[model samples]
Structures are given as structure tokens and as C-alpha cells.
Target: MSVISDVSIPPARTAAVSRRFYITAWRWHFYAGLYVAPFMLMLAVTGLIMLWTATISGRDGEKIYSVAPQASLAPVSAQAEAAFGEVAGQIVQYIAPRTAEQASLFRVNQGDASYMVAVDPYTAKALGHWDRRNGLYDLADSIHGTLLIGDVGDRLIEIAAGFGIVLVITGLYLWWPRDNSGFSSVLVPQLSAKGRQLWKSLHLSIGFYVSLILVVFLLSGLTWAGVWGEKFTQAWSTFPAEKWDNVPLSDLTHASLNYNGVKEVPWALEQTQMPASGSQAGISGTPEGQPVTLDAIITLARALGFDQRFQLGFPASETGVWSISRDTMSNDSANPLHDRIVHIDQYTGRILADVGFADYGLAGKAMAAGIAFHEGDMGLWNLVLVTAFCLAIIFLSVSGFVMWFKRRPRGATRLVAPTVSEPGPLWKTGAIVMLGVSLLFPLSGAVLVAVLLLDLLVIRHIAPLKKTLS
Candidate 1:
């Protein structure tokens, strides 16, 4: 027998090991894409619809138009009154217009329902009113978040997002150019190629281009999921309400500030407890003998340099404070660094707690900035970039499905997944890395374990299933 080198494996063994690793990765990638592609397509389409609707027409017809910017504008109180007159409800929130020519939005509560009323600032005329949560934009957002099935859908989407990460990894591995293949093979699609080659080129190139953005979108969107997001990441990353000096705490959280069940509160503060309004626990900003009206709070907000677009959340109860917030979450300002939330006593109009972006923890600050970018709120460029990213996602999903269908045996009823081989040392290393990832994302981890069990106990044992899958 030929003497084997003590320091190195035989070339044949090395090639076999590499091939096994590739097959294993491809198998996992195929399964993940089989389930995740549809959801990814849904999210991308809905996200695109929401982005355009929010950017161009505004949510729920909140956008108002005027003939031109007037030299003088009506008082916010008059605008609030105009909105209430149109909606017939207790005014709960006021949104200042970003520009004089734009319309102001007032949120009104009528019985159990909440409505958004648009009033032209220049004319103080009620432009329109609609149910805040029942609008087209909100519908699209709900679909994106929960697939219109609530918590179950949220969990499913979270699993899909987790698999999405796996899909990207495996895709990158398969797309890795070898030998003399260079930038053109990796970056450019071979449109001139026929059949499977054409599909593979388009799928790989587009998937590679959008991989980073897909990760960002999935991570940010995961921040809102019921499990990994709400119970794990958000629970720890939330702004600490205890940072308030000697302030009376409320039983409720900053989640209470979410008007009409919409996520209006900043991401970092959403779970933080709200400071109560009693005990004279704040600095006085109330004018002498002047009630804290919408006008007064608007004036105070302006005085504090919340000049452009800012939101005022009316006191929820007798002890609740009027919440004045100016943050990138609401697209109030372009800079996340300037995010601020001020609570004025409903009874005393005193500034209770003033939390700024600088006060947030490292994670909190990152989330605040991440949310702004995720929403495409930075500028037109941001919108265009996200739009392209969304389109790429849809194209990738569709291309993946097309490639799968074309590769399957004609008229086959079973799923034609890649064949799996026994794990080599390299395969085991990949498994270890995935285990770490699963630990970080609990829901994802659970699903991964389930898949492993199914493969070992069910898929591998059943004759038809094994034949179909492999």
C-alpha cells in the first residue's frame, strides 16, 4: 500500500468530505426555502405596498393638501376643534404638521373606537376622518406582522425568518465561485443562458445582492415578534424606567401610549413603565391660571424646541401625564440622536420625566436608529433603497420556486429535496454554529430541533418519504 502522509488527508478523502458538506448544506437550504419562500414573498410585497402608501399618500388618508402655504395659520386648538367636529370624539392626541402647507392630524377616541382626523393647518378645516387601525396601510402592516392570523401567524413568520437566515447561508455557500470564475459569475446574471442555468444565475446573483438587506429586515421585524422579540430581546433592551429620579411609577407601561393599538411609542420605551402624574414629582411648566389645553401643550412643545413634527398623547387617566414625544419612530425628525419624550402632569402640567436618546442603553440606542432605517424614514434615498431591496426579495423567492419546480421530476407528487449524507467533521462544525444561532433565537432553535427530529425519526425511515425527499 502507498504510504499516506501523516500530516494531511488523502486528496480523495478531502474531496469526498467537501462534497458531503456541500450536499448537507444544500439539503437544509432546500427545505428552508421550500417553507420560507412564500412568507418572504408575502412580507416583501406587503412591505413595498406599505412603504409606498405611507410615503406618497400617507396612512389612512392623513395627508392633506392646500392650494399654497399661507402667511398665517390657525391655532392648534381650532384645528383640534375642527377635527373633533368632524369625528365627534374626545381629542386624545395631536400631531403637528412637519411643514406649514401640510395637514395636521388629531386622534380622537369615540366610545371604543379611535379615529384619525386630518385638518388643514392653514384653513383649520377638517379635511377627512377614518378609523386609524382599519385603513389600507394598517391592513398591509398587519399582514406583514401577523399574516392576519394574529399570534399563530407571528410565530410562523418568526420561524420562517429564522430559516431565512439559513437560506442565505446555504445560498452563499452554493453560489461561491470556484476555479477561474470571477466577479462576473458572482455579480452578473447570465441572461443568455438557457433552462436551469438561467434560473440559477438570476437566483444566485439577486439573492447575493439582497442578502445583507434581507438579514436586516428579518432582524428588525423579529424585534416585534411575540416570542424572541417581545420576551427576550425587547425585555432586556427596553429603556429603563427606573432611571427616572424619585418618580411615581404607573401600573401601565409605555405601551399605553400606543394609540389605537398602533405602535406609536418608541421601540426602546415600549415596554418601560410609565411614570405616574401625582405626588408633585416634576418641574412646573404650567402657566399661571391657564388650563393645560391642546394649544398650551403645543406651545410648550414648541418652546422646548420640538419645532416641527411632534406628537402629544393626551392623559389617559386622572393621574396620567400629557406625553409630548419627538422621535424618529414617528418620522418627526431625521436624527435619532435628537429623540426625546417629555411627560407633563395632567394636573400640574409639570415636566415629570424627560428621556432623550442619549439616556438609552447601548442596545436601546441601536434599536432606535435601526427602527428609523428599517422604516425607510431617513429620506427619499432610504425609500428608494428599501424599495429595491423589497423587490429583490420577491424576485428571489419567485426564482427559487421556479428553479425547484423545474428541477423536480415531471408530475411528481412528493417534495424533491436534496439527499443528505452522514455528517463529517466540517458538517458537525456547521451544526455547532447553528446551535449557537438557535440559542440566540429561541423560536428558531425550537423549530430547528423539530426539523432534526423529523429528519432522523420520520423522513429517513419512511420509504416513500425518503425516496421523495432524497
Candidate 2:
């Protein structure tokens, strides 16, 4: 019952206009496809790998628990001792806790790959050993993150994100319904045009509906990948201190907003001997101070009720701090966990600057939130939405290619359009200049320019002698 729904057009004119708009969209899709397909394929493949990681991890339907159901999790100190003793006489260097449950595991690098030794916190009983890269989960994650090529692969992912944004914009332009005749063609699949028109509608409609999701997914992903990744991290570092203003705790507005060199302070500034100083050459050992074992730090942290799965960083200087950053994955607003930085005195083993989780700025909180969003950890609803979006992308890419293939030339007859009469010299020159600017943002634009060159110089000129070329 829509106003335009009943409108009709002359059959001949309708056919002519519909074909024109369809070709324009097809050509735009063609140019963009040739430029971005390689990157898209890589992203698609890597995305598949990442999705498979979640599927494989959950395949068994068994709950992965760090703590034993029967036995209580022992004190952090005792758990560390048991784990160390179990792995003793094995040339061990450092042992760290992954969870509060003594049954939790720690990573050990023996040779080529890391090993996980699961231990009971109460008695330090060795549960089992697991290879770091034995399963598809590890392989999928590695490929998704680094493409198995490390930093170089990461750069490619970032570039893909940038171009993906362009592809989205251009696709919107090409999909824009020009007139009433093409409205049905743009919105709904054609059941009567064999399977070809049906696919065209499927691809166009899906692209239109999922446009926002695709853009957000790509941008958020870009925020994690390249030089933008550094920016995103720095931006999130300010989140902690921002929330303190409204909280009931002590005032934090006067605290330094800058985090530069904040973690560099010595644990015992005005006290006795410092921990060992870090070497200039590499990550050196602590100076000639009493060594703080993982057990001791874990004991202190647990006594303070720091949640499990937290990461512990050793002091940098001999007088350095032993920083224990509490895990934020499980924190709710009411019982928030502060990313802690405990300046433990190396000599007296006393706690110095015990900056709790509330010490971070607004940037830090935002960063944590951003990471949670990317990992599909925001909530079950978010995970479901992201999964749906990813599947939509797979469909869009495949359907787009299929539509292109179906419209391709056959035998000695190509569906060739006449040359678009060149615009005035100034207009053509100005348009190219504007396109050059677009190229700066999306490398795909440059690829489009190259394809135009091939089309104008080769395809168009050769179209007249199609039989010879064929």
C-alpha cells in the first residue's frame, strides 16, 4: 500500500532504465572487486579461522574450570609453592599463576613451544601437561592474528580495513535505487529471472541491511591492528580516573591525568637497598636485592582479595615496583577491580605505592571496554550479533562474485556499453583530481583508476573486434 508501490512504467523504458542502472552497479562492483578481492579473501579466510577457534573451543561442551570442585582453592602463596616444587629440578626460571584455583595452570617455555602444567593449588599435584599448539584452536588464533607471518600480516589486515570502508561507500552508491522501475529490483529478489536475478537481489539487499554492522566491525577491528592500535590503547588508558569523580571513594580529580613514567618509580624511594637494576642491553635481572618470588607476590595479592587470572609484572629497577594488574574481564561496576600497581620494596618486602584499580583514567576504562567488544565478551547478546554479522559478510562476498560471473561475456558476444561521451576537459581533469584524493584514504581507489585505464585502453578498444580477441 506504499504510495509508489502501484506506480507503473512503460515496459520498454522500464527495461532500458533498469538495465542501465544494473550495469552501472555491476561495473562499480567489478572495479571495486578487482581492487579489493585479494584483501577480502584473506580477511574472509582469517575470519573463518577465528570463528572456528570459538567453535572448536566449545565443541566438547565441558566447562573449563581452574579450581577443583571438591577442594577449596588454597592461599595464593601455597599454590605458587606447590606448582614450583612440582616443576622443580626441571631448570625452571619463573612460575606465574593464571587463576586462584591451585588447579590453574602456568605457561613454561621448554623449547619450540610453550607448555602448560596444570597443578592443584591445595597440594600442587600435577594434573596434566598440554602443548601450546597441538589443537586447531591455537592454529586458528595464530593465523587469524598474524596470518602466520607476524607483523607483516598485521599490516595487511589494517590496510584491508581501510579499503573495506571504501568498498562499503561505493557499494552504497551503486546500490542506490535510481527510479521507481528499479525499486523492486533493488529491494527484493526476483523469483522469475531464474537463479541469477535472485542472487543479485540477495547480495544487494544483504549489503544494504548489514552496512552499519560491516562498517563498525571493520573500524573496531582497525582500532586493534596498526598504528591505530597504538592510538586506541593510549585512548583507553584514561578511562580509570574518569569514573572516580562520581564514585563515593576518595577524590581523584586532583590526580595527575598523565600516565607517562608513572610505572617507572622505585618501590622503595626513600628506603633501603633497591631490587636489581634492569640491564641496558635487554630485560636485565633485578639489582642485588632480595628476590620476590611469584608465591610471595601472589600471597600478598590474594590477601588483598585481588581476583584470579590477573597478570603480575616484576619490578623494573632494583628499587623497582612489583606491579600486579588485576584482571578486568570479570569486573562489574558495583564490585569493580582496579588494575593494581603495587610497589613492593625489594629489601623489606613491604608494599609501597599500592595504587588500586580505581587509579586508571577514563582512557583505560574505554580501552578495556573496546577490547571486550572485539572479543565478543561484552555479553551473550553481543556475541550473537557479531556472529550474525560475520556470516552476513561471508554471504555478501560470495554472492557478489557469483553475480559478476553470471554477467560475464560469452562466446564472441560481450555485453558492451557504448563509450561514455567524455565530459569537458576541465570537468574530467577535476574529477580525476578528486578521485586522487579518494585514493589517499582507500588504496582501492587507485586500483579502480588502474582498472579504468585497462578498460578504456584495452577492453573498450578491443570490444569493436570482439571476434578477433575471442
Candidate 3:
């Protein structure tokens, strides 16, 4: 929607105010774009690679096999044994195929490294194996998440995303069609226009189209950020351990279920405490004669309607329960509403806790659905839509750079940012709003404060710096 429109105002009274507001927004937009453009391009490129690779070759090389489905498939126990035998590591997790044509995947840990063993369900033979976190898709994911610089990169990206919101806001303010510009300027790019005008038109039109999607992506990605995500949003939105009735809690939380730098726990349960297995505190899901084995657990899972690409995480400690989960995060189900997690006692094979989407709180539910939509895990259309949005982001970022280059005088070393005039009441109000945003996102707020200090103390004070920036 347009942020500004033509209105009847006496030029003598409102022209200066409108001009000042527009200039302020344009200045913020320009500076934010200068900082955020690179990260936006990186995220879009890496995100596209991740999406296609995840859909085609599959993460952890799970799609490398092409075995014909047999009339009868090997038992789950035999498949697990075959995978374990091939990898020569402790079996930590089992991923059942979503369909008969797909291969069974097993997560094996040998000492420090973790590997995924893909097995043909028909023959119970290990098809191939690869490093779970080093595969092509996982590599893209690592870069997407942390830029390969770990926590430092994470904070930088988080700050970029926060500023990205500012960029969108200020961008909308600058883009809002006024006077007789009409739908042509808002909906379609004027390819007939040349140089900066054409670039500006394309950028504005494309940016407007993808603005909502970008915001969604930014918010969803923020939920995984270290400080704001882990400490603030996810901390409060997490599922409560009190839902487990009288069961004793383990020292470990559901975050422990995420393996090899991959998040596997349902978004809602990541911060919830894991229930211990020793107590006879749960209903028996296993049959009377059956012992608590991988096969028995499979049977129990199947009985509970986990027939698709559900995952099973073996207990890592003495008190840990076997985790059976099916969620959109793992691409197990397209419908986030069907997300489920069940913890079973490894000793007694009793179902300790069963959580479904319905059990989630309001925030948990929104995050669950938002994450699924963010990852394009909901359906084929979702993937296509997200891909188009990524392309739009890349185009907008590039066009912005092109427009800046064209606007700058030849051989100029200056940043050529918009000139800032003395602050008016409206400008002060806008600054206060930005400060409020900074308070909401601490990292971005800190960066904003630093930029303000630099601008006021250094850029505005020094003649050369002032000439360069203004």
C-alpha cells in the first residue's frame, strides 16, 4: 500500500514539512540499503540454493538413491542394523521414508563426526553415506544461517535483518506514489525510461511486490537468531514442560534433539524440557509381549498414525526418552497443523508425552505455521512463490546499487548520501519511532545508536566527511 498520496495542502504551509519528511525517509533508506544490500543478496542466493537442493538432491544426500520399490520391504530393525553396520557408528536416529519409493535414513555418530546412512527399504542394504552437516544443502544452510563465521556472522545478519525492516519502511515512504503517477508507477516498471530513472522504477515496483515476503522471511529468520530469537521470542513462546503431567524432567531440553548443526525439534518444543524415562509415569503404547526395541517403537509410532516421514531420535543419556516426531521443520508433513511429537520411555516403551499442534500456545502455533511457510515446506506452490520472491530481492538489491552508481558524479569518492537538514518536529517523531524499534531489537538498536553518534559527532562535524556523506 502507498504510504504517501497527493493531498490538498497550501504549499506555503505544508510543502517544507512534506519535503523534510520525504528527505529524512530517503536518507534513512539510502543508508540502510548501503549496509543491508549485500546481506540481502547473500541470503537470497543461498536461500535459493538451499530450497532447490533440499527439494531435489535432498538434505544429507537422502535423495541419491533410486531403488525400485519391492512388493515387500525389509523390517525396520533390519534396516537399522544394515545402516549401523555400514557406518560403524552408534545409531542415534532413524528417519522413516515418507513413501515406499524413498530410502530410509539413519543418523550415525562415530566419535566426533556424524554421518547419514541412506538404505534401500526393500533390501535393507545401505545405499550410500555422507557427512550430515557437510552435504551441499547443509553447506548452503550453514552459510545462510551464520555466513560461516559462527556467532559473529549471526549477529551481523541479525542486525542487517533488523535494518532491513527499516529499509522497507523508509523505502515505502520514498516509493509512495503522489499526484498523477497512478498505477503505471506503482504496478509496472517503465522499461522505456533510461539510466537511473529506469533503475529506480524497477527497484520501486519490484521492491513493493516483494516487501511483504521479505518482511516474513526476516521475521521468521529472526526467530532463529541467537540473542533476540533464543533469548527473547523463542524463550517465551516455547511449549511448557508442565504439559507432561507428573513425569520427572531431564536436565536436557528439546534443543538437545537438534543434531549436527541441524534443527530437528518442532519449533514449539525446542526450549521445552525433556521428560526422563526411568519413571513408570506414562501409558504403554507398546503391545504386551513386545519389548522396547526399535521395532517396537516403530510399531508404536505407526499405531499413533506416524506413517509418513516421521523421525525417531534414540536416547542419548540414561534418562533420555526416545523421541518420535513428525513436523514441517523436518519436511515430514506439508501441513503444519498436523505437527506432532511423542516421547516414549526407552526402558518401558510407554508414551511419556504426546504433543500436537493443537497443544501449542498462540505464539507457538503462529511460529509453527510461519516457519513452515518460510521454508517453503507447505507445498509446491509455496516453493515457487518463495523462489520468485528471492529473485525479486536480488534484482532490487542490484538495481539499487546500479541507481546509486549512476547518480554519483564520475570518480567521486564520497558516499553521496542524501543531505540531512535541521531536524523538525516530524523528524524528531520519526527518530523516536526508530528508537522504539531499536529497543525492540537490541542489536539493531545498538547499531543505530552507533550510526547516529558517527553521523553527529564525526560525519556532520568534519568538513570532508560532511561533504562526502551529505
Candidate 4:
């Protein structure tokens, strides 16, 4: 018992208010899980498939990326020429080998689809070629990013991820051991518990351990979302165009390089203005009057500290400048701090501007490191850790649905909110938190508005809905 207004407040009343708060949190968690569980499950499955595909095979197939080690290596130009002989199209990008045992990659544009031609670095042999859009990596990645339905799917996923974040927040609050329970009660699943309690214990312990990694996954994944990431976050964190002193800017951003729903460019630099070519204001690069070739650019890239693993992007148009980068998002290096992107004048081959990881804004810097961790691009240990975390997410999603199915009343399986009969508003305690989450993710905010309207306009008037929720 406690004093509220100089009068004694009954313990039962206090407990009722507390229980309502618990119900409120639980109800929100239930709804969020209902919506997000499917997306989370899909994302986890696709992500796991991608990780395994990348680990065991090349982007195309088993032999494309692998090559025999050789003491001698062919010229970079020769590798491109060899790949060009096979694809016989404009080479838009060049991917350097990550190891001596790996083949160099070239992107050849043929009509609407882009072809990936893997060439041997030593013998300049075109080992194999395949349409990148039809490849396994892009197939899994597009679904992971956009569900393969383009912008609409992207928005849906963004909403789910945003709401998923809220789910995590409310879940953490609900899972906090506020009772007279010890650490082991929450940290370890109770083996003695049976039925729903057993599943719940397992869910709570899994959620507790995997929460941080889940949040990372959500945030990093959102970095590619159409609205939340592109419109809002990118606006604030994009590298300033003014950095390219006195250089003419192109209408396109580095995002133009992203192909077939796969992000080949670094997240931090995606929205940065791409500089135009035909400029004299640049550092000494290709010698004057010397025709810039793939060989020259490759040598220059090596001299500039970009070793084996880097990308060379050809200009899309006549005025477009060449882009050379080695970013962790593209699996160039394990260390995010080593990320770098340099633009060069196509005609002059002059170094127009160079941006590194340190040059990104605070948000950009966080995303730079975050994307690496999210993609398991760091190393072998990182790959294993992320794989385990993704597996945990799959289990969490399945177990959540199991718990719901067990407790749902007959004929009310669409979505059932936990019963709360507190006298006042259930939203009172969590309004600010909900508002904050909505503001942080605008797509989620829009969906929240729709859901609120549904609750007020439809659910309140419907007998089954009102009965199930209230």
C-alpha cells in the first residue's frame, strides 16, 4: 500500500494499474509479432541462404570465383579484355580478386540485364559468365531487400522492420525480471516449465540474448529501405556535394551504380553526388593526352592503396566520371575504417575527389560499420556469429507464432490483443515511446496511423474485435 493523494492507495489497485501496463506492453508485442514474424522469418531464411551461398560458392556458381594460384599474373587490361571477349558488351564495372585463388570479375551490360564475367587474374582466361540478375546472390538479396516486388515490397518491409524495433523495445521491458525472480530465471530457460510457459521461457531467453544483434540487423537493413533510409536518413547523412571543389556535378548519385536491387556501392556514399568528367580541376592522374585504359586505372588504383579487393566502376554516360572504391559493403576489406571511394575525370583521368570512411557524417560512419556487421563481411568469426543470430531470429519468430496459436480463442485468430480492462487509457504509459518510434521511422509512423484509425473506427464498433481486444 502507498499514499497517492494523501489517501491510502490499496495494493490491489496499484497491482491492477501495473498489470494493465503489462497488458498494454504485451498487447503491442503480440500485434507487432503478428505482423513482423513472417517478414522476419523470410528475411532470416534468405539471409542464411545468402551466407551459405557466399561461403560455399561464387555469386554465379561453384567455379566462377575460384582460380588456381599462380606465380605470374596477367595485366588488369588483359583480364577485362578476356571477359569482354565472352560478354561482348560495355563493361560497367570491374571487381578485383579478394585472393590469388579468386578470379577477377567484370560486369558487362547486355540489353536490360547485366552479365558477370569472371576472368582468371593469372592467365586472363574468361572462366565463366552468367547474368548477374539471374544469379543466386541477387535472387536472395532482392527478396531480402525488397521482397522482389520492388518499391511496394520495400515499403512493407520498412514498416515491418520499424514496427519490429518497437516489438523489441516492448519485449525487453516485458522480459525485464521485475518480480522476485533471480537472474537465472530470465537468463536461463526453466526446464521444469511446460506447455506455453516452456515456449515463453525459451522465447524470452532467446529474445534477451539476440535483442542487440536483432536491433543491429533491423537498423542496418533499414539503411537500404526506400523511404526511411533513402528519403530521411540519407538526406541528413549523405556526403556533401560541395566536397568536390568547383567540379561540375552529375544529376545521378552513386546510387545509380546499384543494380538489380543489389547495393554495390557503400551505404555511406550512396547518395553522394557523382562528379562529372571533362574537368581540368583535378590532381595528377593519367598523363595528359594519354588515353585512359583499364590497365592505367588498375595501376593507379593499386598505387592509391587499393590492393587486391577493390571495384572500378565505368562511367555510365559520356560525362560520367569513373569510380574506384574499396568498401566493406562490397566485401573489399574486413575493416570498415579502410573504406574509401575516389572519383576520377573520365577524359582527363584526373583524381576529382576522394572520400573515405572518416569523411562520412556521424550517422554515415555508424552505418558504414553497421552494414559490415549486418552482412557478416568482417571475417570467418563474424560470419559464424551472424549466422547464429539469424538462426535465433528464425526460432524466435516460429516460437512467437506457436505461443499465439496455443492461446488464441476459437474464431479470433486473425490477431488477438491481450485482454486489458484498466479503467483509464491503455496508451497512457507508452504514448511517448510509440511516438518516438514512429517519428524515427516515418513509414512505420504512417502504418501506425492507419492501425490507430482501424482501432478507433473499425475495431471499436465491431463486436468480435472489441470483445477480443478489450
Q: Rate the local accuracy (lDDT) of all candidates.
A: 0.83, 0.49, 0.86, 0.85
* Every model: Cα RMSD to truth: 2.4, 10.5, 4.4, 2.7
Query: Taking the tens digit of each residue's C-alpha lDDT, what string does model 1 give over 181-202?
Result: 9978879999999998899999
Query: What are the per-model numbers of colliding residue pairs?
Result: 0, 28, 0, 0
Q: Of the pair 1 and 4, which is ahead by TM-score? A: 1
- Which segments of candidate 3 are over 4 A away from where they belong? 1-9, 421-425
Can you rank all candidates by TM-score, best first?
3, 1, 4, 2
Q: Of the candidates shown, which would achieve the greatest TM-score relative to the real structure?
A: 3
List TM-score per model, in order: 0.94, 0.63, 0.95, 0.94
lDDT of 3 by residue, 1-470 (tens): 76887687767557678777888888888888999999999999998998899899765566777678888878889999999889998899998887777899999998989998999999999888888778677877888889898999999999999999999888887888875678767789898998799888889998888888888889888888998899888888889999788988998888888875577677779899999999889887787566799888988898999986889999998998899998988878889999999999888888899999999988788878988998889899999998999899999889889999999889988988777575555677678769877988899999999988998888878998787776
Candidate 4 lDDT, 323-427, residue by residue in tens: 899887776778999999888988888999999988989988898899888878888999999899989999999999899888877776356558776675455
lDDT of 2 at 157: 66
Residue 260 lDDT in candidate 3? 54
Error of 1 at 13 (Å): 2.3
| lDDT of the structure predicted as candidate 4 | 0.85
Give the higher-lDDT candidate: 2 or 4. 4
Residue runs of model 2 more than 4 Å from their true location after superposition: 1-28, 41-45, 51-67, 81-102, 111-113, 133-135, 181-193, 227-296, 299-305, 313-321, 326-367, 411-470
Better of 1 and 4 by lDDT: 4
